[model samples]
Target: MKQPLLRYPKALVLLFTVLACLSLRTVTAQEIRIVTEELPPYNMTLNGQLTGMSTEVVQAVLKEIGVQASIQSMPWARAYDIALNAENVLIYSILRTPQRELLFKWVGPVAPTHWHLFAKPGSQIQLNSLDDARQYQTATVKQDAGEQYLQSKGFTVGKNLQPSNKYTYNYEKLKSGRVDLWIANELNALYLVRQAGDDPTETLVSALSLPDLGGDNGQNMAFSLKTPDALVERFRQGLQAIRSDGRYAAIAQKWL
Candidate 1:
């Protein structure tokens, strides 16, 4: 009468085993969480869509690597904090400063960023050189790469105008005369001007040309230190594929 007849519920056992396998796979599949601020022509939402140069470039790489990503549009500070403190998180199109170099795994020089200074129409603040603009009050996003760059260069930022969560505020500051100099990438400045329905003829934007800052071009994507090396390699391979296949160039042409 040994165990000739007592088979445990085979169907139930199989169901449990299947569910466990699925759970394991779900846990193992590489996932990267993204947090981004509203940096326009790069990560801004147009008509509620997250369509920008960096956004699209990243999406293409992610698709090629077969990893899924969840993007949250939030303040840049919050986003950077999340990437710094959380696992499997990344910040994108960020400048690769020496201080931040060891902080995260990095990828991509997606495109060049030409740092420019904008002025209101008919304003007499002339910048014959980067040194010339230091005398005037400049408006910039708090703790942003640009701010850090200017501050490092001994550019005095007066009144520290309201923190800009998006590029649009630069236009507002220029229009209201709240800031004598507004620093931004040229393409983004153009996007802001276009959004205001103003032609370039109505306003003047000049390149500040920080030679030290200009070389890197500020086009980098970064992943949290917590993200696995295997996934990072996947991202690298995917990036290479896109670059070799001309996908990256196409994306750039669309926006830049």
Candidate 2:
């Protein structure tokens, strides 16, 4: 019987090399599913297209890695759940908090966002701290970082915290005086107010800054824990490349 050629030392090495290359190619070729919400300036749908600061950054990273992905906009709760449970999932503009640090593989500081406690203009309510805000009804999108942050601080949903599936509804509740305070991203809150045909500067007043409520660090693109480390590292390198090449800055300028 003739010995198998692959069993030879040199042939075995070559076979292993080919197998490794094939494995890498297969991983790179796998499709990545991106999930985001309609939070303008970060991720949103415009003219039936998905485009925003974080979206552009994500696209650039994917392009750098030669991978293609389409961003899907859905309710925060659904998106969060999917990203948590599914493989090859990427969620952008996610606050990288201590509680979430170990849950997902992170790829960025894609954008900046400051949490604010917003009250209708001229409202007597004032929040100097998270505890102060707890005294009144606070509106937040369900499963959002803001909601999670507040809950972590002991604000119970359906009691002090008013959880809405839609962020627009939270803004509406604030504008209608149904909720005393709206815990939201400053830029997102302004965008929502402007989209609702109201001047944000006049319609909503920032009563307090909730810095580090979720995380003081900038927002990031996070991948599911089930995602391969090699794939996550590829994205991280791609993001770094964009940042060093001025593509990241240019994209952010377009939105900011």
lDDT of 2 by residue, 34-104 (tens): 89988887888889999888888889998998887678999888999999999889998788887788989
Q: Which ten residues in a row have the lowest lDDT in candidate 2?
A: 210-219
**Top of the candidates by lDDT:** 2
Query: What TM-score does candidate 1 reach?
Result: 0.81
Cα misplacement distance, residue 197 of candidate 1 (Å): 1.1
Number of the top TM-score candidate: 2
State the lDDT of candidate 1 residue by residue for 87-125, as single tens digits.
Answer: 877687687776677888986666677776777767877
Q: Which stretches of candidate 2 lie over 4 Å from their true place?
A: 1-17, 214-217
Q: Candidate 2: deviation at residue 103, Å? A: 0.8
Model 2 deviation from the true structure expressed as Cα RMSD, one decimal place: 2.3
